[model samples]
Structures are given as structure tokens and as C-alpha cells.
Target: MKNLLIAFLFNFLCLCVQGATLDFAFQLGEKQEPRLDKLLPDVARQMAFSRDSKKLIAKGMGGTVVKWDLQSRQKREISRIHAKRWFVYSIGANQLLVRDADDNITILSLGSGDETLLTNGQYESGSLSAEGTLAVLSKGDNEVEVWQLAKQGPKAVKTLQTSFPVRNGLTLSDNGQFIAAAEGTYGDGEGHRTAIEVWNTINEHPIKVFNTGEILGVWNVLFSPDATMLAVDTQKNAQSGIRIWEVETGRQLLMKSGFEAYWTRALAFSPTSDSLASGGEGGNLRIWDISEGESVIWETYPTGIQSLAFSPNGEYLAAALWDTTIQILHWGTSHER
Candidate 1:
């Protein structure tokens, strides 16, 4: 009877290990290959999805913007704007934040083509909220400037002072109440350390700090739609590790490795905030079950992925590839093992 009981315990442990290593499958519904490199004179530099996920917009190097209807798979050129060092960071509420040749920031209205000046001078780095209502700009200092964007104009509302040097990849909450930024430094010595700081704009205080030990750098930082979770992709030991945390309690919930560090630039949470989609070097696409802490690697592409977005209904996922094309993937029939 003692030997039998020991054998049962060993079997149970093996079952648990198998369950954790199981791979969930994702159905590839359709790959919308725009072939932007052949169609346009210049390649598409960035892409964004509409709020409802019915449409997608791609911005090219020559200031040409094209909108595609996901249902029909048809596309048309929408607008054109000239800029020397241009970037389409955010698009929502019919507005896009861009930088002009003179290094000045402006908000361009998508409908009327009217431009509103945001900052007269150039900023070292900045991030615009997905809702297009809030923006955070850094000037290579310990402080970051927050602006409230509106149809009438842009107003400087608050300045977030950090305890450490502010790195790139600033993320602002959609509600304009909180901002998350990567702080600290990277080096070969023991003195090097990195941490992500979350600040409260309303009360002008720092709320939470997540320490990332011995990572070379952090590429991206994102807050969930409900502001309950924060996810970041960092480089550690020449590989990439994605970490997710509970915002309120400052608890690290999950950490996983196996992605290339240099190209892991995309991370998006599902609408229900139960799953997260990550894509990066080697065109590896994965969806992580947040609650279970298990992941499903759907596919690998020839090139790396630049960005990822989940539809509002959480039915489809959009992956913007480095080769200037996009893929639309649907959830498989069965996600549970």
C-alpha cells in the first residue's frame, strides 16, 4: 500500500507538468497581404486599427495614408501630409499626432485636415494614448510633460517627475489619469538596474514601481484597458522575457522567456483582459492565457512583427509584420486543452 501511494503521487506530478507545457492552437482565418512594398513607392512604416476593428489604416514613408475595410478586404488612399521626420503614433477620435519638418509637434484632424500645434519645440520621446485624448512627452530629463488633447487645442496639464532617468516607450492610460514609463539604466556592472514607474497625474504622485532585475533593456510597456494590469517586454541574458504585473498590489504575476530581445515590440491585451498577444523577432505570434499562465504559439513568419492589436470583441487579432504586410488571425474552435 505504501508503494502504491508513492506511484500515484508521481503520476500526478507528471500530469501537472504536461498540462503546463501543452500548446493551445489558434486558427488562421485569413492573411490580408497588402503587398505595400510593391504597391506603394515607399514601404509602410506603421499601421493602426479602428476603434471598432472594422477598418485598418497604414501610413507610408512618403506621407500617404491608406485605409482598408477588414470585412471586404478593400483599401483606398485616404490622406497625405508632408513631414521630414514623421511618425504616426496614435490615431483616434479623428485625430493623429505627427511631427513636422521643423521638429514641431502637431495634431492633424483626419476629417478636415486642419493642424493644431502641440509643442513648438522638439521632444526627445513621446507617446500618445490610443484614445487620442492624452499625450506624454519627455525631454531627456527626469520629468515628463502630460498634455490633454482636444478638438479646440492642446493644453499642458501636468508634469510627472521621476526618481530615475526616463527611458523611451512611455505609455499613457486612456483615461488620462495615469502614466507608465521605463526608468533606470542598463550596463554590465552590478550598479545597473531597471524599473518601471507608474504615476498618478491627478494627485501628482508615484503609485507603483516594478523592479526588473539584470535586464539589458525594456522595449515596450503597456497598460490594460481596465488599468488593472501592466505588461512589459525586456531583454535579459541576450533573450527576451515578458512580464505582467497586477497594478494595484504591485505584484509580479507572470514571467516567460523564449523570444528574441531586439524585435519583441508588440504586446496587446484582449478586450476582456483575460489574454495577451505578443509578437516579435522571427515573426513568432503567441497568445497567453493570463489566468492560467500558459501560452500558445500560433505561427512563425519570415520576418519580425512590429505591432499587434486585438479586436474589441476579442474574436480576431491583427499582426503588423516588418515586411509591410498584415495578418488577421481568429481564435480557434477550442482554446482549452
Candidate 2:
């Protein structure tokens, strides 16, 4: 009977493996098998997949940071060093940055468990590069500051000043060459902001100021893996849209509209930058080819997605949901029954 059970499991996994051949994101209307539904200490405000792939770090506004082993699913609390009211600002290969209640930045090394203070005024929003060498932080009003996280500590690298007020968040390219800033002229109740500017970190100047030319706003800003493209999404009731632009020319490469972005936190490009996946307020997960515009290639369940991150090898997508559960979409294999 044990041998028979083993044979059944093996055959089931093989069938699931065949199912995984389809691009998981593009499998519209297909049931998305839950790979890992991890519970968190608190509602995850944001989460990141470490480049090392050994750890998955998640944090919430309640000043809790939890680290879980991607393979073993072992949970460990590492929120000992953050401020009273802190939010995870950025996650690097082996480091984590937090914004404390006092509005200062705390850089923590995962290996040594050492906390380094980076006092550079009040940083409300920030992004750390993949290499963990550079950080871009934003103050109250569209004042973006860049710092170098060198061996000595974080030092002032550059400053980017914008004409409008910052609306949502700031994102830095993996190479740390470009920074995207979301600025708002006005905000509304249902998550509406204004335009965004992609600035070259080299000179701290805006390369392009993007506006939707309609009654919409750009919220989350992200750069493609190769750093040749920038993507931004708008959030509102019945006025959802996502756009991708050329990095050097600021040309609109693609634009897809008519989706629900309200209360949805899904925007991540595959590690190869060939495709993009987004989860919406309506609990729908969609994937699109970067080269194709005005079309969705695939979709999945309507789970209220709050945040998303891709594994270092690009095999899995970790989604932090509004339901206080972290769902991992392992683009391949069906180890869960």
C-alpha cells in the first residue's frame, strides 16, 4: 500500500508538471494552485524576495519583519531592531532597510544582524538597488535623495528635486542608474494621484514627465529588468491602466487599460523582463507580454493582491494578499496536493 501511494503521488506530480508548461501568468481562467499560503505576523504592507533566494522577508506597518526560508518554510522574527513604528523600506541581497517612527533609516545586515543608522533627514519613501550599493529616498515633498550604502555607511550621493508633490512611492532600477518618482497634483479617496517622472541618477534630472492625458494617475513605478523600460499603473474605480515606456526616449511602448487597480498591489516583471504580471482589486491576476499592448494574455483567481515579488531565479512569484496570507506561485511543479 505504501508503494502504491508513492506511485500515485509521483504520477500526480508528473501530470501537474505538464500543466505547468503553460506560462502560469497567462493561464487565464485556469485555477491557480496555491503553492504557499503563509500567514504573517501582521498585514504585510510590502514584501520582497531576497536575491540570495535563501530568505523571503516581509514587513508590515505594525513594525514586524518576518523572514522565512523559501525552501523549508521556516519562520523567524527579525523585527527586534526596527523602530517603534517602522516600515520595511527596502530589501537587498542580504540586507534590509527600515523607516522608523522618527522618520530615519535603519540599515540591517542579514548575515551579521548588525543595525546601521543612516541619519539623513526624514525619508518617507525609498528603494534599494539589487546590488545593495545604492538607495533613493524621498522626503515630504518630491524631494528625492540618493545615498551610497558603502562600507563606512550611507553617504549623500545625489538629490532629485521635482516640481510636484510626491504621491505614492519611489523605485530604483536594478543597476541604480534611474529612479522613478510618483508626484501628485491632487489626490482623491479611491486611490488617485498624478504623473510620474523617471530621472537619471547620474545627473539627478527628470528624463521624462509622464501624464496619462486623461483623468487618471500613475501610482507604482517600476523599471524592467534590463533597465530599458519603465512601467507605471493607475488606480481607480473603472479607470485602471498600465503603461510601459522606453527608458532612453520616454516613448510609450505599450498601454493597457480597463482593469481594476483599486486596492490591488500587483506589478512585477519577470526576471528576464519579457513579460509582466499584475493582480487587480477585483481579485484577478493577469500576465501580459511586454511587446503586446491593449491585450491580456492570461489570468487567474481574484485574490486581493496587495504586493508581489519574483524569486531571484524567476521561477516563483510571492504575493502578499489583503487576506493576510502570502501566496507563492511557483511557475513550475505541483508539490502541493
Best by lDDT: 1
Model 1 accuracy (lDDT, Cα): 0.67
**Structural RMSD, model 1:** 9.1
Note the residue pairs that clash in candidate 2: 26-298, 28-299, 283-302
Measured on C-alpha atoms, candidate 2 has an lDDT of 0.66
Query: TM-score of every model?
Result: 0.78, 0.79
Worst 10 residues of 2 by lDDT: 21-30
Error of 2 at 40 (Å): 9.0
lDDT value, residue 49 of candidate 1:
70
What does candidate 1 score on TM? 0.78
Each model's C-alpha lDDT? Answer: 0.67, 0.66
Clashes found in each candidate (C-alpha, N, C closer than 3 A): 0, 3
